[model samples]
Target chain A: MTEDTKKLLYVMTNGPENPDKTYAPIYTAALSAAMEIDTSMYFLMHAAELLKKGVAETVALKKGGSLKQFINMALENGVKFYVCEESLRDLCNIEASDVIEGVRVVGTSTLADLALDADSVISF
Target chain B: MRTECSREWDTEGELMAIINGCEIPDELHYYLEGSQMTWIRLDGENATIGLTDPAQTRAGRILHVRIKAAGTSREKGKPVATIESGKWAGPVHFPVAGTITRVNEQLELRPVLINDDPYGEGWIAQIKVTNQAEVAGLLKADQARTRFNEIIARDNVKCIRCQK
Candidate 1:
């Protein structure tokens, strides 16, 4: 790891369309963790629906595996997982404890802080 | 000429095969110029990469897989992931220099996917290559199978997944 390594901020906005869009950001963030780069993934809008218990485990990409599987990979490897607090409440009507173990529900300011700190940001 | 190949699609919809005695699918690209056993699929600057059937079979059934983090550029022919099997342990190297976009995180919990489905669900990484032309320089499909047959024969290697 170097000071120059790019920290990634991945914004996931889609959810359960095919229930498959969620996989990309989680996979990307997990890969960033594997590369030992600093990384964070923020779930926004309908994407917050994925954090509801039992949803992620059931969604698997054709060959990429399940969302829970991907999230576990991200969590085990130290990628920060977050759900938009506003989105969680306004969209899913859920609280932080409603999310799976690794996710934290935070406000937009946290999202901004993470995005600005990242050397690179991508959205899915 | 396309080598004769027979694949048994796993119950979960992935493909695997043992051509002659070693497993080498007829679809993956081969970086065989210097005789590396990596497989890559180049579409523009993005590529999906993994080990050839022969390489995976030689490694035995992978018991674990650990890939490097994404968002980092790797030089061509550098180690990207490490796999441990009951009989052998080895590194999965990339065939081109690029920033790794993703890894098959499925392997962390089910490392056996490498042995069970190396080409599909078992893929090592997806790289955003710096040079797509470098990947174009590698062999594809039939050419890869032909080279794989020669290598398997030369080394007298025999590979079988041995699923119960």
Candidate 2:
């Protein structure tokens, strides 16, 4: 892949329940936006839990700043969020109806394909 | 103040080691300062290791630290640890072959400790070196700086934190 097309970002880890671990996806998405790249956040493993609409809000209420707000900002700025179907089933134990709006449930094969296709694949 | 470009060696005073352009605080001693990379040599038959200042700056805030357990034998160039920052997670190869004796438990509490104090509290692992001869293959402070500059130039790495 060409350097220009290498903008996709993959995040396979869970969002922070603690304050210290909060910067990973936050700064990463911000950096991608700064670079003006076509950013994609792939939620897999324990990471799929972040896509639950109320979950971010709940964490925000506890932490003071809205994680949902940050996610919304990313979404409004054109960050594509994808939830892995297999991970959602196995790890999250959730059905399609349980997820937040605007999330696309995709197979594990798609993740591999995207990783291979993207010019750069960064996992947090 | 102007930075000196001259390559002059200070052969008079006591040897103060530096790593990747950053001063290795007097409390710490250099174990393996190979090229642009440097690993902290911990005390005892087992030694703890981690990235140096220049490395942490280039990589950004560390997010995750994946390590192997005690008793596992590892080879040089083999990934002894895997660290993830904001954008990347990759293997950190060792300079010497050894068996892992201990891993820093502090990393589980705060992985950013690696970025916070790489030379101090953020040490990665303790290894019992199987071959002490590999220690001779490493570099020192002055050489490390030159090699680091070369690497940044070769990779075309723009320093986002510090403007070149």
All predictions: root-mean-square deviation over Cα? 14.2, 15.3
lDDT of 1 by residue, B37-155 (tens): 77887777688988766667665566777788898687776668866553333456678888889988888987767666767777889999886657667887788777766665555
Against the true structure, whose TM-score is highest? Answer: 1
Q: Taking chain A by itself, what TM-score does each prediction score? A: 0.89, 0.81
Predicted complex 1: CAPRI docking category: incorrect
Please give, for residues B55-93, the per-residue lDDT of candidate 2 as tens digits.
655555666777777887867766567665534334566
Worst 10 residues of 2 chain B by lDDT: B2-11
lDDT of candidate 2 at residue A66, scale 0 to 100: 53
> What tens-digit string does per-residue lDDT give for candidate 1 at A1-124?
5678779899999886666567666766766665557788999998888888888877767743467756765676568888899998987787777788878888989988988888888988
DockQ of 2: 0.04
| Native-referenced Cα lDDT, model 1 | 0.71
**Which candidate number would show the highest lDDT if scored against the true structure?**
1
Query: Which ten-residue region of model 1 chain B has the weakest summed lDDT?
Result: B2-11
